[model samples]
Target: MTALADQTRWLDATAQAALVRSGEVKASELVEAAIERIERLDPGLGAVTLRYFDQARSAAADGSNGPLAGVPFLVKDLLTDVRGQACTDANVALKAQARPADADSPLVARFRAAGLVLAGRTASSEFGTTPTAESAAWGATRNPWNTALSSGGSSGGSAAAVAAGMVPAAHGTDAAGSIRIPASCCGLVGLKPSRSGARTAVESVMDLIVPSVLTRSVRDTALFLDIARGDEGPAPADGYLAEPGKDPGRLRIGLLDTRIDGSPVHPDCAQAARSAARLLESLGHHVDPGFPAALGDSTLDQLFAAFWSAGMGDLLADVARRLGRDVTASDVEPLNWALGTLAADLSADDRQAASEGVAGFARSVVSWWDDRDLLLTPTQAEPPLPSGTLASDPAEPMAPLLRSTQFAPFTPFVNFTGQPAISLPLHTDTAGLPIGVQLVAAPGREDLLLRVAAQLEAAAPWGERRPGL
Candidate 1:
C-alpha cells in the first residue's frame, strides 16, 4: 500500500471522501486499500463476516458521485441489506441458509446514492438480541484496544472494523444501544437518530430501531444524518453543520450519573458523565444532577422485554420458515431462543398491555425534554467487559439478557422513547478502554444533538486518539 493509503485507513470518512473528490486518490484505490486492511486485520478481529471486495471496487470505479462517494462502508449483518449479500445477522441458521436481499433497504440505498462503497457485512449478535457481538456463528469481535475484551454489539463488528481502521465508517442499527455501545467501546461516535429517523423497520421493537453509523468524528455523523434521514426527519434538508460553539447558545442540560434504575453506575462510567457535565457547564450550559423520573420506572424493563422477546421470537419463526425447519437450541443462540419462546407464549392481551405501557412510558420520558434541553448519561453502566462475559448458557438462556441490564441499561429506553441520542468518546477507563458519555435530545431534535456534540468534540478532541494494534 502507498503511504497515503496507509494514512487513509486512519482518516475519517469525510477526509477520505474529500481525497476522492479532490482527485488525490482514486475511488478504486480507496476500496482496494480497505480490502487489504480487512484481509490483513479481520482474521484476528472477526469484525467482518463477509467480504464483497469486487463489488466495492466496481462501485468505486463507477458509482454515484455523491458527497461520500468512494468511501468503503460495511453493513452490519442485520436488518439492513446490500443486494446480493447474504445478511446472516450473525445467526448460524441464517448464515447457512439465508438468501441474498433482492433490493436495498431505504437506508442502504441512501448510503449507495451518497457514493459509499458497500464493502462487506459486519458481525452482529444473533438477531441483535444481545448487546455483545459474540455468537456461535461468527465468534467474537475483539476490541481493537484490548483483543481479550468484547467490542460491544450487536454492532460490535462494525465498531471493531472502524476502530481497527479497516473502514472509515460502517452501517449499524440501534434498537437498544447496539450502535452507541460499540461506539463507546471502540472510541467512535455512535448516533441513534429519532425513531422516525431513517424510516427502516429492522428489529422493529414498536418501530424502535433506527439506522445510523459509527464514525470517528461528530461531523461525519452529522453529515451522515443529513444524507440518510427520512423525509419525515425534522430537518431532512439540513446541510453540513458547522461548530460555531456559541451558535447553539446556552442550554439546560441534566447530568444523570447513574443507571436509569437508580442503581449506581461503574465508577469510570459515572465519572465520565460527571466529567462531560463539567465540560458542558464550562461551555456556558446549565448542568444539573437530574434525569427524567420515567427513567427510574423499573416496570418499563418488563414492558420492553414483553415486546422485545415477541419480536425476537417472530424473527426466529420467520427464519425457521425460510429454512423449512424448526430452529431449536442447536440452531439458535440460547439467549435468543429463550426470548423466542417467550414471544411464542405472549397472547393478544399481553401485547396490548405492553403497547399501552410503552406508550405511557414514552410520554413520561419525552416530557422530560419539555423542560430540559438535553439529558447526559453514561452510555453503558460499565466499561467493556471481557470476551464471553455476556455469553449465554444453554442451561440458563435468559442469563445473558438479564446480565445486559448491568452492562447496558441506559440505551434501550431511548429506543422506546424515540429520541435522538449520541455517544461520544469523552473519557477512558484506568486501563485505557474508552468510556462514552451519552447526550440525548428530544424527538426530531437531531440537529441540536449534532451542534452540541460538535462543541464537545471541538472542546475535547478525540478523533486523533487511535488504538494500538
Candidate 2:
C-alpha cells in the first residue's frame, strides 16, 4: 500500500491513539492526512457536507490533554452541533440558518474531551427521514465500496468517510438503522448504544436517536464507547476495554433470518445469516433459528411509524417556521412528506396509543433479551442499492421504497427497546459488497456486545479489506 493508503486505511481508533500518545504521529498530522484524503476522494463521493480544517488544527494542538488525543474524526451533520460549523440538517430551507453553536451538544463535548480532533461534518438526508444519502442541498453520498451505490443514511457521509479511509472512525447517529445500514454497506463496524448510553442531554426531540460510531475494527468501537459513555453512576466492575469473558459461555443466540414483520430477507442476505450462524456454531455458541416472541406482532411497526411521523412533523414545523417558509408538503422528501401528512391527521388518542404501544413493545423486547444475551439477524434485507433508488418527489407515495428496501424493520426494534446493537462486517454478496450481521444486547450490556464483537473481529478481521480507490 502507498504511504497515504497505509496510514489512512483502517487504523482503529486505539491504534491511532497509541501512535499519537507515543509522539509517532501528531493530531495535526492525522487531521491533515484526513483532509488530504477528503480533498482527493470526496469530489466523486460527495460524502462531506462541511469542512473545519482551521478549527481542527487548533483543536489538535490543544487536544493532547484529552483521552482520544490526536485522532481525527467526523460528526454526522444531522444531530451534532459543532461550534461555528454548519449544522444544516442537509435541507436547503435550513441552509442559511447555519450559526455557531453556543456550546457543543453534550455528546460532541464528550468527544472533544476525549481528545478527538473534529475534522468536519459529514452529509445526511434532509431532516434525516430517508434511508439513502441523496440530499437536495448536499447531493448524494456514494458508497465508498461502489461509487454507483448508496453509502446509506442519514449517516451515509460519516460511513463513507470511514469506509473510504478518510478517517479511522467517525460519529454517526441511528434512529432507525442509519449507522448500521451504512456501516454494513461500506464494510465497517457500527455500534448503536442503548439510548441512555448515547443520550444527548440537550437534544430531547428524539429519544430514539442514539449517537454511535462507525469504525473499521471492534476495538475502536469499544474504546470510543468507553470514552463516550456516561459516568453518572458507579464505574463498572471492569472497564469496557476488559477482555472478552472467555467465549460468552456458549451463548443461547436467537437468530432471525427473516424480517421482523414477516417479510422475507433477500436470498443473499439469508445466506449471509446462515453463514453467520455457522460461524457462531464454530465458536461454540448455540444458534437457534427463531423469532423473539416480541417480534411476532406487526403492530410494533405501525406504532414506530406513528412515533417517527410525529418526530418529522415536529421538525418540519420548527424548521419551516424558523426559516419563514410556508411549509408546504413539497418542501420535504417523499418519505418525510408522507410522514408529515400522517402526523397532521393523527389525533390525541392516536398519539396516546402510539406511545403506549411503543412502551409495551419495549418492555416485551427487553424481556426477550433477558432470556438470550444476543440476538443475531441480517443488518439489512439486501445489499446496498444504487443511488436515487430510494429517492422520490416529496409529493409522491412512500410504501414502495419502504417495503422494497425493507428499511427499519430489524433496527428500530433495538432503538425502541433502548438496547445496544452492533453491525459487524462479517459477510459479503456476489458482487463483493459487504453484508453486515447485526448483534443486539439488552440495555446497559454494551460491554458484553463489544466483547463478543471483538472476538468476532479477531476471528475475521475485515479492516484490511477495502474497496479499490
Candidate 3:
C-alpha cells in the first residue's frame, strides 16, 4: 500500500468520502486500502469471516454517488445482508448450507444508497446469542488491544476490524448490547438507536434487535444515522451530522454506578462510570446517584431469559420449517441447543407471562426518563474477559450464558425499553484495556445521546488511540 493509502487508516468515513468526492482519491483506491488492511491484520484478529474484495472494488469504481460514496464498510454476518453473499450468522449449520442473499436487506440497501461499499462480512456469535464472538464455526475473534482477551460479541468482528483500522466504521446490531459490548471491548463508539430510529420491520420481527454502526468518531456515527434513518416517519429535523458538540443545554442526568440487580461492578467499570458522571457534571449537566425502581425487580433476569429463549426457538422453528427437518442438538452449538430445548419446554402461558413481564419492565423503566433526560452506567459490569471465558461448557451449557448476562447486566434493559443507548471508550483499566461508560436516553432521543457523547469525546478524545497489533 502507498503511504497515502496508509493515511486512510487515520481518517473517518466522512473524511474518506470527502477524498473521493474531491477527486483527490478514487473509490477503488480507498477500497483497496481497506482490503489491504484486512488481509494484513485479520489473520490475528479473526474479524472478517467473508471477503468480497473484487465486488467491493467493482462497486467503488461504479457505485452510487451519495454522502458516503466510496467509503469501505463491513456488515456483521448476522441480521444485515449483502446481495449475493452468504450470511451465516456464525452458525455451523448455516455455514454448511450457505445461501447468498437474493437482494440487499433494507438496512444494507440504505448503506449502499448512502454510498457505502460493502467490503465483507464480519464474525458474529451464533444467532447473536452470546456477548463474546467465539463461535465454534469461526473460532474466536481476538481483541486487538490484547490477543489473549475476547473481542466482545455478537458484533465483535466488526468492532475489532474498526478498532484495528481495517475500516473506519462497520455495521452492527444490538439486541442486548451486541454492538455496545464489542465496541466497549474494542475501544470504539457504539450507539444502539431507539427501536423507532430505523424504520424497518426486520427489527420488529424480533422486537429487540436494532441495526446500528460502530465508529471511531462520534461524527461518523452521526453521519451514518443521517444517511440510514428511515424516510417515512417523524425523523430528526436537521439530521445528526455536525449535530454533535452542538450546545445541548444543561439536562437532568441520573447516575447509577452500580448494577441495578446489585451484582458486583468491577472496580474499573465503576471508576469509568464515576469519571463519566464527573465529566457530565463539569459540562454543566445535573448528575445524581439515582436509578429506576424497576431495575430492582429480580424477575428482570427471568423475563429477559424467557424472551431470549423463545426468540431462539422461533428462529430454529423457522429454519426447520424451511429445511423440512428439525434442528437437533448435533446441528447447533451446545448453548444454542440448550436454549432451544428450554424454549421447547415453555408453555404458551409461560410465553404470555414473559411478554407481560417485558411490557411491565418497559413501563417502569420509561418512567425514570420522566424525571431524567439521560442515565449513566457502566457499559459492562466488567472489562473484556479472556477469549474462552464464556465458551460453552459441554458439562454445563447454561452456565456460560448466565455468566454472560451477569457480565452485561446493565445493557439489556434498554432493549426492552426501546430507548437509545451509547457506549463510549472513555477510560482504560490498569492493564490498558478500554473501559466503556454507557449513557442512555428515552426513545426517539438519540440526538441527546449523540450530543453528550460528542461532549465527552471532546473532553477526552480517544480517536488517536490504536491497538498495538
> TM-score per candidate, in order?
0.95, 0.93, 0.96
lDDT accuracy of residue 302 in candidate 3: 75
Kindly report which residue stretches of model 3 are placed more than 4 angstroms away from their true locations once superposed: 197-205, 233-237
Per-residue error for 422 in candidate 1, Å, reads: 0.4
Across 192-249, the per-residue lDDT of candidate 2 in tens digits comes to 8887643222122387888888888876776777777647533222466564443556
Per-residue alpha-carbon lDDT of candidate 1 for residues 1-469, written as tens digits (9 for 90 to 100): 5675588889999899889999998999889999988988889889998888888888988856887989999999997767887878788888888688899988898889889999899988888878888989988889999999999988999999999999999989998899999999999999998876322222337387788899999778877887785453444234533432336789999888977656788899999999999999999999998888877876666777888887887788778887788878788888887888889889988888887787777887788888989999999988898989888798888988888878988898888888889999999988878999899999888778888988888899997788987
Q: Which number leads on lDDT?
A: 3
Q: Choose 1 or 3, whichever is better by lDDT.
A: 3
Q: Which candidate is the best by TM-score?
A: 3
lDDT of 2 at 437: 87
* Candidate that beats the other on lDDT, 1 or 2, i.e. the better one: 1
Q: Itemize residue pairs with steric clashes in candidate 1.
A: 131-153
Pairwise lDDT winner, candidates 2 and 3:
3
Worst lDDT run of 10 residues, candidate 2, spans: 196-205
